[model samples]
Target: MKQGFRLIALLAAIALVAAACGDDTSDTTTAPSNTSTTADAGGTTTTTEEMMTGPTFDIGVTEEPCEGGSPDRGCILLGSVTDQTGTFAAASPGLLAGHELFWARVNASGGIGGLFDVDILDSAIVDNGFDNATHVEAYQGIRDDVLALAESLGTTQSLAALPDYIDDNMVAAPATWWSGWNYPESDAGLILEAGASYCVEAMNAVDFAVSNFPTGAATVGIVHFPGDFGEDYLAGVKLAAAANNLDVVYEQVTLPIALDPSQQGAIDAVLENYADVTFLVMGPNETATIVGTVAATWNASGTDPRPFIGAGPTWNSALLASPAGAAFEGGIYFNSAPWGPWATDTPGHAALRASAEAGGAPASNFVSAGWVEQYPLKATLEAAVAAGDITRAGVVAAANSLGEVDYEGMVETVADYSGNSIITSSVVSAVDAAAPDGLTLLAGPFTGPTAAAHDYTGPCTG
Candidate 1:
């Protein structure tokens, strides 16, 4: 079964590359020029237009030495610490499934440089999430053994241990970014945001709301929990609203990690002063409670129609299914990743389904992000191994070198990794439960000129 799946993955990747190559049908690989040519005998002509060549991969085969003592049977150890219990547990299992699929295929096809073995350590940081100390301990536990770290989800915990991580020379494939993704130029080696910062997601969601939501007073209210994730997003919504000329009204901060604040009066206060657009920048459980509270109150009054808007984290499939889900009838959100089920035709999706089915994961849209993220993570590490150097520096360099990457055609735009901050595309989707797919895209990747392209908009500005 593993061999068959690996074969399928290779064929899929080759098919994708072939399709992309076919899209480029130009010949004259023009070289760079200095002088301009004359168009009308005496008139000055524009400089010759040069065709841009895409990135080149090491297509040929190469071999490298294995790092560990485990019977040199062609393998390299890549470290991993997943949040399999806490807030991120929702996507943790699926992400692991993706890793399994990627490496399974890679090893089956003769491994990286004819060697393959991914050593993963279950970083037992679950529900409430891991602290900085825990993150450092986990890394220290296996620092001397692995070639590179694949995926570590906690931004706060990881950022806390960033200093040691850099000193140890570990190249992390992808890290979940909070508002503070923009570190100084010196820390560039340690930062590789897989998706857009949560702030970007907030800004995009606000932008979508302004253009599409039912027009009214234009006042906006943002409710958030008092954590890095919540605070950062709340700040982002305000910034986006200010730039877009939208009003900013009531804002609240609840306790840490509590789904809903114990104080009912506080919750009612925010609900009472609602605006045309309300941004719930809280975690999953709290988001559900807030929505449920509002819905129950409004339903009791028998009247009052207001649109609630939330960032991606708050828009969980389970939460939306709750009674509070009904309150968000006109709610909308901005997401950094593609809508999973909606993208059934994408290569990423095909690969994800194959892996999930094989691994016994529930085939749900929510699991697709972890599913797709794992593929690129795997491919990035494989490329690093192929480079013949498994040191921390090698891993980081390999990650940065991944140019214009498209995940099996799953992601809409190619990932851009040029500056200190990694920038990728963002998708705008509306929270419409009535639709066949539940959520729908409003405007899209908006990969236009004027949008922040590879530009690092620094930390929280509130």
Candidate 2:
């Protein structure tokens, strides 16, 4: 619908070219046409005319250049629906900065297919506040203006918009790592997810704890919130526990709103079971409260502190300054991450750091995550361009056809979109005050036996 003005302008240009050719009175100097030929996904050769003119598009693309792009190039606009002022607000800024930085680099290097510059306008980025309804509302507002979503954060929040996304033929790079994103049956092949799922991460976490702390980790406890984020991880923890012959001594599911001033319920559960190791699948605040309280209680009782492994979202560098800082520093907390931290030695990490430095963005693992998640979308768009069709439906086709996305070693390359190809390895990190993100790599990008051997038929939640 937004293509009206551009279509009119294109018609006018065609009319002028035709009129000039018809005029025999004046000596007309014709400019040489720039043309190229390429092969499509099916190996059919297409010329520039066929590739450029045969393809049709409706919204979120324009013949006009982007604000900072060369006048000769067109623009492809994308949107982002994410938390800017909600439960995940602390990490959103860095995540957004990472998106901007990634696109900036892309535009600077000559954007997709060397034909269009990509832009995610600030006006098109709406704050979902980590709420499902808000996420849907934000998406509805920008559905007609963006060719695709560059970032859609949260598991349930993204799921809330799935039906509309399918109807609109919109593709998105999800910010959450829910296991459901791996299956086309669950995501309808619309979500371009990066890294390992939360479920697999939990499996690896349990495997890491049991293998590393053999003397102390014979039993495990799980503390989580109720929905996909928590329950997904719980499923994997249980699977790994059974695989390793470790008993699940405790399971506590509590809400963030309920645990606010005090995480007494979760802490009491931990104390009662006194499991050697606990897997946390809650927010950073909840993580800090439970770890801090449990550590203090254990010290008071003169009991040795037990190790706590947390899913990626449950650890933030800011927690290092909270009351739990000492407990984290005492080697009691570890993070199970989808990818390496900000300081990982990889080409992708280096590029992200350079972009962040140029933009003066703060160092955070969320920034690394945000940067990593864009790869799948970038690959899909490129694929669509090669297929001579960048329309919404074409983009969806490109996404489903992708074989593997190169993250430049930020994490293991996602082999494919199938559930069987789901990445199972995870990076485990330990609290370190001196590390760039206050966390240092302790073990992984490694796949433990449980995750490596487990059959992934569908989403853990299902």
Candidate 3:
């Protein structure tokens, strides 16, 4: 992996040199010739010169102001490849809205280094359809037109475009929370991932289940998809189940499109195993199907239903309006999140809420996720601007050099990128029809003993 990264970096350097030497006037690198003033996080006024001459940037940046932005600043265009019409389609709009709102707020607050207003234009946004080939094609379509990807919405999808990202020195905020994003070698130091990974979240979820619903020698059943998303969560559950002395008696690897679209196979597996608790790592529709079916079955049979815990992506507040609505309201389901819900009490959450309200964006956990995911990228861009080199390679370097990023209390502060310093804590929530986003906080922003003690080495799926 190290060798691969070195080779990719070498090739990127050669490509940059070739582009610089070519007759392509559009590929030229130039430093901003104007002076700009900005207030630092400390609220102190600082001149751009204090850092360095304006950044020498290439690609995805222009001297022209962003759409709807002040004409005084240049525009930094970031691309996005997300699910707009796929299995996760219901969650994509909120995620994109969050990305837009975050940038809007940044532009309103004087933009990056007071020189560039960032934009993730809808025109540049591509729909990946939650398919790997579609994701690769979507990325290829916009690779040359953007500075970086503000969002790439799946584990396999991002992985498919990763080789190209490394070759282009493009940095992206991964929408998926696979544990591999935390490792530079795994992702070529390019994925600017936010929040706890599905791996850690699963571990914390298992611990939460055991602590809240104690059953001596409890048994656990896992229903998941087969790839990185599901496999990563499965790995974590195994670790936590071992630590808690819980028997994992059932495991089902299936797809949402399968199981008769009702997830009958999964529901039957859960019923047969009758584990004290079940963990789900699938799409929202599948989650609703399995959870609702199981709950309804138990109720009809006069049997008490066990709790069903879902990974972040497995939930959508819209489920409350489905036939699963009654089942969800019956306290048979819980969810593990990378951060607090939409109504979390924090400066960041407050800002997000304000942005959503002002923009009329839908209230959804995916929206909060979309907002939270941008913090690392925002910090990286700011670092690049401050270092006087907002080029593609410069952005990657800036991302790696950061020791931390402030999330304004939305989640724990992001640790440095040089090692496995990914946040381990997770937020746990339960269904609440009356709560914002239909989720009420149960416990969270907390790390389970298993996750806290687990050895950090590499991707769980790997």
TM-score of each: 0.71, 0.88, 0.88
**Number of backbone collisions per candidate, in order?**
7, 0, 0
Off by over 4 Å in 2: 1-55, 257-259, 418-421
Candidate 2: pairs in clash: none
What order do candidates take by lDDT, descending? Answer: 3, 2, 1
lDDT of 1 by residue, 1-462 (tens): 010001111111111121233464543222232333444555544443332221121211112323332233334556666564555566566556555565655555565544444544343222224455666777677666555565666666666667876787665544354756545443455554455556766776676676666565378887765666777777667767777777787887664343444536446755678677777765556666766777677668875757666666555666567766666554523333334344346666676666666767655444555445554455555566556444456566776675555567555444454343334346666666654335666666543222353245557632
- How do the residues 11-47 of candidate 3 rate in per-residue lDDT, one tens digit apiece? 1111111214546445443333233445556554423
Ranking by TM-score: 3, 2, 1
Reference-based lDDT, residue 459, model 2: 89
Candidate 2: what lDDT?
A: 0.83
| Poorest lDDT segment (10 consecutive residues) of candidate 1 | 1-10
Best model per TM-score? 3
Error of 2 at 102 (Å): 1.3
Better of 2 and 3 by lDDT: 3
Of 1 and 3, the candidate ranking higher by TM-score: 3
| 1 or 2, greater by lDDT | 2
